[model samples]
Each structure stands twice: as C-alpha cells, then as structure tokens.
Target: MASPQYRLVYWPGIPGRGEHIRLVFEETSTPYTDTATTSDGLDRVLAYVQGNVPDDNINPPPLAPPILQHLADPNNDTNVTTISQTSNILLYLATHLPPGSIAPDPKTDPNALFYLNSLALTALDGLSNEPHDCHHPIASGLYYEDQKPESLRKADNYVRVRLPKFLGYFERVLGSGASGGGKWLYGGKFSFADLVLFQCLDGVKFMFPKAVSKYEREGTYAKVFALYQAVSERPKITEYLKSSRRQKYSDGIYRYYEELDIEP
Candidate 1:
C-alpha cells in the first residue's frame, strides 16, 4: 500500500540465497521491496554487487546478490545503506529494526539473539552452503553436466553423511527443553533461525525428494520436519508460499538431479 522502506536485491528468478531473507519480511509482514520496480532495477542491483557502487565510509562493496538496502535517517543522509551476506543481513535487521522485529532484543537478553543467529548460521552452513557444492562439485561457474561424476560423488556423501548430521542436530534441538516442546527452535518463540532452517530443508526436499521421502517415510528427523510444517503453515508465510513471489528452485543452489538424489 505504501513505499516499502526496505529493499531486497536478489536474482530475478531462482530463490537462491534470497528466500530466507524474504521469509523474514513475509512472516512479520514487514514492508520490503524485492528488487526495484523500475528499468534501472537490474542495473542498480548489479552496480551494488559488481563493485560499481563506489564505497564512501564503508570500503567493501557486496560481492554477490541477496543484498539488503535500507535508507538511512532521511534527515541526516538520504543515501541508502547496503549490506550483504545472508546471516549478516538477518542480524542487522534483527538489531537495527525495532525490538521483536526479527529476534529478541539484544539489550534485554543478548543470548536470545545470540542463539538465534548461531542456529541460523548452522543451518546455512550445513544445509545451504554444503548443498550448493553437491551440484557444482568441481566449480560454481562450471555446468552441472560438465561435472556429473563429481556431483554424484559429492551428493552421495552429502545425503548419506552431511544431510543426516544437520537434520539430526535440529531434531534434537527441537526435542530439547530449550525448543519449548517442538513448536519453536528456541524458547518457544519465533526467530529468523526457524525461517533459515525451513528454507534449507525445503530446498533439500526439492533437491532430493526421494531422500527426503526415505526419512519422512521412516519417521526420522520428525521434529525438524514438524518445525518445517509449522513454519510453512504460518499465516503470512502460507500466503507467500501460494503467491507468485515464491519462485521455483532451478538454476540456483538446490537443484533436483535424478542421479544424485541418493537414498540416505
């Protein structure tokens, strides 16, 4: 209804590393524009990511997409502030925005945000980062076809070893008292960590449906899947999932490869 103060710079198509960032705004109904709605939108996003946007006070520019931009105090400076990296952006939003915006207030209980961020990073590390390497085992720039043999080997280890490690860790966390009996990841409260885990597993499901079905069918990692279900069913997130904003996974990190979807 109004001009959103927050802007999300991500690739136009695949979710890539941007979906978790989008989930924060969607779950909270926070106003955020995913890319600019203008002819210069692509150009501007590239400028920030490709080092065309010269640094003033901040020296390093964003080297990739999934960048977040918010206007500084209009009274002091009209320039938009840009920050990159998934976890960094999430932490920034949680702290810089009003308390209870994404996670607990850093001042009252620093441990809450600390735990939230820690869990989020763990999810991204095992589920997000490692999964990407499964397909592009040789190199990110190389096509999957060029590295099929390597992808198969990497994916076999991923689904057999890495996937269960991450899933089991979250499952135990959900069952622990700190998780408040499976509804939430920490203290029975919503956090961006929950969103991160959801996106990661959701991608896993897409990337390796057969492997996921084996676990689901065997009832392993039930708590993590339960948490995934709970997050997806949230009112705003539910709407967002069914909406056009939710892009399908394809050329991004999580990709479905028939041969690579090994049973764990």
Candidate 2:
C-alpha cells in the first residue's frame, strides 16, 4: 500500500499562493491532488478545518490557499497535514526534493541561496503590502474606490521606489553568479530562490509593465528575466504551465488593475 497521497487546499479560483506549491510539485514530478476547484473541494478543505478531517492525526493550519497535506500515512485514514503561508510551503517542499534538488542544503552554507530566498520573500512581503494599500489604503476593511486617493499615493511610491529596489537586488544576484557567468539568480544550480524571484518578477511586470520595462533594461537585471524565460521553457514546466494549473494574471499577488497603472 502506498501513502495516502498529498493534497493541496486552496481557493479554486486564481493560482495565487497555491500555484507556487503546484509548480514545485510539477517540476519535481511529484503526485498530489488539488482539493479546491469546486464546492466539493471547498467542503473538503472546510471539513478539515472543522477537525472533521479523514486522518485524525493530520493537523490544520490557521490560514488557507496554500496548505499541503501529507497523505502517505499507512493509517489509511483521512487525517490531513495542512500548512499555510507560501514561503513555508515552498521551504517544506524544498527539503522533500532529493536534497539539493530544489534548494541548496543548509550544510553547503549556501549563502547565495539563503540570501536569494530572503530577498525573494522580502519582495513578496512588500508586494502584499502594496495590494492591501491599493484596496484599503487607509484601513483594511475600506473599499479601493473609497481610498482611491490614498491608494494612488501608496502605489506611486511603490512604483517609483519600492518596486525598483526589489527588482534591482535580484538583478544583481543573477549577475553575480560566476559559474554560468550570468544565468539563474544563484547561478549553476536552479534553487528555489530563482522560482520565487521569477514569480515576483512576473507579478510586477504584469501589474506594471512600463515600470518593469524601465528597470529590466537597466542591464543588471537582464539575467534574472532571462532565467525566468529559461525556467518556463523546461519540458515538464512547459507542460504544467500550459495546463489549467498555471494561474492567470487576473488572479494572485500580481493583479492587474488598469486604473492603478498611472504614468507620468
């Protein structure tokens, strides 16, 4: 008998956070079921949260949209192991991969890898803040239109400063790799950091194309963009991306709101 199998519980719509986990599993050729594509999916997830999980031992995290369930327990019960937060999920998956497969082992003192991951998460944190600002510039519960004026101010700063700083750091990281002499963020090995960076780059590019074009041309970050294209071209990745699993720009951290794109 094989393990119960892993389950990813996330919103049925928009790839968003869960997509990161999906992409990693696809890249590693791991088998897992997406448990949130319909009422059944949502119910399955809700049931787990309510402590009605099939596997009595599997624990549920506090949040949603990116929980990984380890179903391989021989207990044959529906007990689930749910993990929240995209970064944590990615890190967990990184360890499961054949060591050094997704990310550098902590033993190698992969300073570059560690730095790159940190940089990626930092960008994501900033990105999340920006979105909240756009929707609830003054307060989280307020509407975007109600806070349009304040949202514009916040968005302006992000576009002019915060976004560039984040992009620039990754560009430098990619350029520093000596092994391939400018390929991949960490160079030589394709660590999880690159994956996270690519997602960030794409998010910003989609939300603010003009701004991204301006920074991407700055030369220092060219390799980072190139790495994104290269990774997308990987055979397995290409297939996975083509499948419905790959999220659309409309959904996720990098949402497109034309009104938000203000040009000088």
Candidate 3:
C-alpha cells in the first residue's frame, strides 16, 4: 500500500503559525492535506492536542496545533508518525523530503540546515512571538481589552526597540555573503528558512505598518523588504496568497491594532 499523504493539522481560519509550514508545501509543490480546511477539521486537530487519541510508541501526543503526521511505515499499518513545533516541522520537511527541496542537504553543506534554522528561530521569536505579546502582555487567556494598558506599553517598546533590532539583523544578513546577493537567507538558495522568514516578516509588516514602512523608507533594511517582496512574488506563493487557503491576519499572531502602529 502507498504511504499516506502528508497531513498538516492546525487551527482553521487564521494563518497563525501553520502558515510557515504551509509555505514549504506550496513552495515545493508537495501534495499534502491541510486538515483545518476540511469538514469537522477542528475536531481532528483537537484529537491530537487534547489527548483524545490513544498514546503509544510510534508517536507521542502533541501539545498544540501545527502538527504533522505521516504514515510512512507501511509495515506497521497502525502507527502514524506525529511531529509538532514550527521549526521541527520545517526541519523534517526539509530533510525528509528530497534534499534541496526546502534546503541544501547537510551532508553537502554542513552549515546550511543549522544556519537556516537559527535564522528562522530568531524571526519567530522577535517578530512572531513578540508581536503576539504586544496584544497579550498580561496573559494569553485574557482578552486584549482586559490588558489594553499594559499592551500599549509593550507595543510601544516593541515598535521602538525590538522591531528595529530584528529588522536590522535581517537586513545585515541580506547583505552578508551568505545571502548571495539579497535573495535568500543562506547560501544563495531558497530554503525553508526563507519561507519561515517570509511568513514572520509578513506578520510583522501587518502588525506594525508605520514602523515597517519607516524602516523601508530609510533604505537601511532595503534588502529585508526586498526579500519579503521576492518571496511574495514566487509563482506558487503568489497564487497561494490570492487563494482562500491563505488566511487573513486577524486575531492571530499578527494583529493590527491602530494604537500599536506607532512609528519608531
């Protein structure tokens, strides 16, 4: 029997962190099932993270959404290999799929995978996580209105300090020899890392337009914005963006509160 297709399990309706994984599939034109869009999707996602499934040795239960499950072991029909975490999923796709589909094989270039992952992790932390914190500085369980005042302070500092730090770092990376003339994050090739950065930066731009535009106008981080544009224009990505599968940034990780758009 053939192996089951790659199944991406994540919350529906918003891009959220799952988008980073989605881009990889789209970029490589790999066939996969996005469970979130199917009928009764959330119920399937809930099963893994909510402990609705029986636990065993093939794959441990996951803690949250953005799960990847593949039934690659044909010999054992019952055990599915489950994996979680944004970077972990990306790494698995990069390495497990044909090498260079998402990134160069580590055997050929020892530093490529690690370098890409490190950059992706940094973008996730400073751009994605930090922006989410701006709206929920007090607690994730609380509503944004419940923590508006503290959120204002956090958003202010993020726009002025954290935002610039991340943008500047990516800008420098674009200029570094590793970027190969302002195209990718490493070694002049489009890796899963580029896809990860593209999603994170897209979220950053959506959340802090004024500040992102300010840095763009300065031309200091020109390459950072350029890389974003390049990724946005990729044939597959462009199509995905126009498709309904590309969820809009709403209450998810990247939210645009007018007050939080303060220019740095």
- Which candidate number maximizes lDDT? 3
Each model's TM-score, in the order given?
A: 0.93, 0.82, 0.94
Kindly list the per-residue Cα lDDT of model 2 for residues 95-200, writing each as its tens digit. Answer: 6667776776767754645565575587567655465455467886665668887877877788887776766666676666443466665647786666666666
Model 3 CA RMSD to the hidden true structure, in angstroms? 1.9
Candidate 3 yields a Cα-based lDDT of 0.87
- Candidate 1 local lDDT, residue 50: 74
By TM-score, highest first, what's the ranking?
Answer: 3, 1, 2
- Tens digits of per-residue lDDT for model 3, 83-160: 999998888888888898889988999888888889999999998999999999999999999999999999999989
Model 1 lDDT at residue 79: 69
Screening candidate 3 with a backbone cut-off below 3 angstroms (N, C-alpha, C), the clashing residue pairs are none
* Residue-by-residue lDDT tens digits, candidate 1, 1-264: 346778889877688788988999888788777863445667877787678877777535788988988866433435678889999899988887678766878777779888898899999999999999998988988999999999999999988888888999998999899888787898887889999999999999999898888888778888888888988999899999998889888888888888988887
With a 3 Å backbone cut-off (N, CA, C), the pairs that clash in candidate 1 are: none
